[model samples]
Target: MKRRNLLIAVILLGAAVIFYRAFGTPDQLATGAAMVNVTVPELSETANEGEAAFNRLCASCHGRNAAGQDGVAPPLIHKIYEPGHHGDASFLLAARNGVRAHHWPFGNMPPVEGITDPEIAEIVVYVRELQRANGIY
Candidate 1:
């Protein structure tokens, strides 16, 4: 009888663990809910050229304000891409060479074609300004 009870308890504990992993913890659920909705503020054109370049090149996937398209790409306004975490050089590298998607489930980011280094710099400036305005900095 004691052995049967212990087995039942272990099975119950295992089921609970599996359920949590599949459904996620409360905090994970909350975070997911939060990410589902995001507010993108109006961009202050600190770098007009950059803004133009971003609109011409990156707006489709990243959104006009860099708020990011759901399932397509992650938002740049998020803290994950803050300057401390992903610097200006990271943007250049991403433009020059495709980046492996490590942060989001959107898969790999293909390298942008036909954009000059100077243009990329300008886009970086624009993105950084947006990040700052949105308090991601």
Candidate 2:
């Protein structure tokens, strides 16, 4: 009887593993945890203005320093977002028009309202500088 129960337990465990592997994020993102450790560098005057704008507009979801909030958003400092792949234009477009979820499990990002074109541009600069500081470039 004990052997039979053990075998059943093993089967259940295997099924759980498969389910998680198929639909789960293997990192801390699900809990809204910070996904990466970021090192901030001194910013240019534009970047500094961008940082303030980011804090006001983007920080609620993107997290402080753009480290990313698990289950909320992906870090801009990640390699997938390096300028070559995502580019400056992508960021600009995303702020103006919401972006669909393509590279991440965080779902779609809606268009950010009440922010101007110039502020969004500055935010991009801040994000790029942060990415550079973190060795993502």
Candidate 1 local lDDT, 1-137, one digit each (tens): 99999999999999999988667666544221223233444655646788899889887778766777755677777899899999999999998998998988677999998888999999888878777777778
- Candidate 2 regions exceeding 4 Å error are 1-29
Per-model TM-score versus the true fold: 0.68, 0.79
List per-prediction Cα lDDT, in the order shown.
0.78, 0.90
Candidate 2, residues 39-97, lDDT tens digits: the string is: 99999999999999999999889899998998789888899999999899998899899
* Span of ten consecutive residues with least summed lDDT in model 2: 21-30
C-alpha lDDT (0 to 100) for residue 132 of candidate 2: 93
In candidate 1, stretches whose alpha carbon ends up further than 4 angstroms from where it belongs are 1-46
For candidate 2, report its TM-score: 0.79
Best by lDDT: 2
